[model samples]
Target: MNGRMIYLIGPSGSGKDSLLDSARDALAAQGCRIARRVITRSADAQGEAAEVVDPDTFARLEAEGAFAMNWYANGLSYGIPRVVDEWLSAGDDVLVNGSRGYLPEARRRYPHMLAVLLTVDHHVLRQRLHARSRESAEEIEARLARNAGFAETLMTGESDDLCLLDNSGSLAQTRERLLKLIAEHRLPD
Candidate 1:
């Protein structure tokens, strides 16, 4: 059986990292690999475990075909490494921290991949972004606008492959839902 790619996409303050952390812990005993993305931002900027690369470095890597999927979003560069194919071929479910802007291209490239869109309500998103303290008030507002843009852009294309999980209420609830989604796809038929 071919391994699967579970692609996760969400807004900046949607608790993606938190959800991913819980998922990793929950799926630790399973044959799953959660991908660490290559991002053109500081390592600690968003509290996500990503390879921090400079703009020039990111551009060079992109030219070198080091990424399976890559895109520019919110003034930053993000990429999913090419090793994903290897993981999938080896029959291990690979979970990737992905981008909304890159989904169309990503779907074109990995049609079998499971796309998970994690989200929260507008007020909750605002509160979470402010609580992170990583972005200024202006940046937070801009991020909200970007979230709306992503909603419009992501609504098209592959509805069947898309799974939505609202991360608004509590971390445990969202984590359980994510785990079930992963298990549904990860288990052998």
Candidate 2:
């Protein structure tokens, strides 16, 4: 199978990370490589491999040609490091559980990238954010507003450049849908 990059984009609290974790596990069992990102955001304080770095350091690295692409989201700077090119060069399908806003830039850089926009219902998203216990009521409201703004930017009609997945239901359903898409696209070996 030809190497292709899959980039995941969706709003905050949209289960992108959880779904990507499961997808990565399944894909690795099949010998595919899943890519990780570096972020300037603070760690989850719950031991997630956040690759945490201060803003200044992240900026320096970006200036030094360390990142393949860099963008800001939810008030944090995120970067996909240049090492991803090496993996792509070696014929690995790079699975990136990252922001949706990166789609246009990634497409310009990696012509074969498959951009998937995962989504959850507004109620489901609010529930997820509440369960995190990381935000005040006011902060949650602000976050939801920001997500709405991002959603607007992403609401264009579909094309080969975009794939939309609604994830407001069970994990099994979401995984099944994802697997079917990957197979249909011949993205995984």
Candidate 3:
């Protein structure tokens, strides 16, 4: 059978990274192949655990057609490298960490792609961003406003299906729910 892609799309402070980390380890234990995304943002701002890629090199890779899908958001450029296509082509499902703004384009490209929107209450989002402290207060407020509008568009988009993973609960609880969904849907791997 052909493989499919499961994309996790959300705002900056919606706990997308944490949820993905937990889900990745759990899915790996069950034999799933999760794909890591490359972004142009500074590694320091992204946190200590993220893989680092130079923005210039990422751009070069894109120009050389190394990415299956790529886009810019929030002043940062993000790309799903062609290596992901190689994996999916080889019958391995790829769990991609992505931005909500790219959902419509992604769906258009891969009609069968499973898009999951990670969500948290606005208050929670504000608090989380504040904790991250990567952006100044004013910048954070601007992002939150833009993120709100982007989230709405993603939620209303026409696609095969849209799954919402609420991230307000404990990390373990969220991971459990994600695992359940993957199994129930028989998402490719």
- Give the candidate number with the greatest TM-score: 1
Deviation (Å) of 178 in candidate 2: 1.4
Off by over 4 Å in 1: 44-46, 186-189
Worst 10 residues of 2 by lDDT: 41-50
Tens digit per residue, CA lDDT, model 3, 1-189: 367788888788888778877777778775567776677777667552445578888878988998888888877777777888777777777788876767778888777887888888889899999999788999999988988888777656663399888888788998898888777766544
Q: What is the TM-score of each candidate against the true structure?
A: 0.90, 0.87, 0.89
Candidate 2 lDDT score at position 130: 88
Ranking by lDDT: 1, 3, 2
Model 1 clashing residue pairs (backbone)? none
- lDDT minimum window of 10 residues, candidate 1: 152-161
> Candidate 3, overall lDDT?
0.78
Q: What total of clashing residue pairs does each candidate reach? A: 0, 1, 0
Q: Identify the candidate with maximal lDDT.
A: 1
- lDDT over C-alpha atoms for residue 16 of model 2: 75
Per-residue accuracy of model 1 over 1-189 as CA lDDT, tens digit each: 388888888998899998888878666667778888898887657588889999999999999999878889768898889888888888888888888877777788877788999989999999999998988999999889989987876676556668999999999999899888887876464
Two-way TM-score contest, 1 vs 2, winner: 1
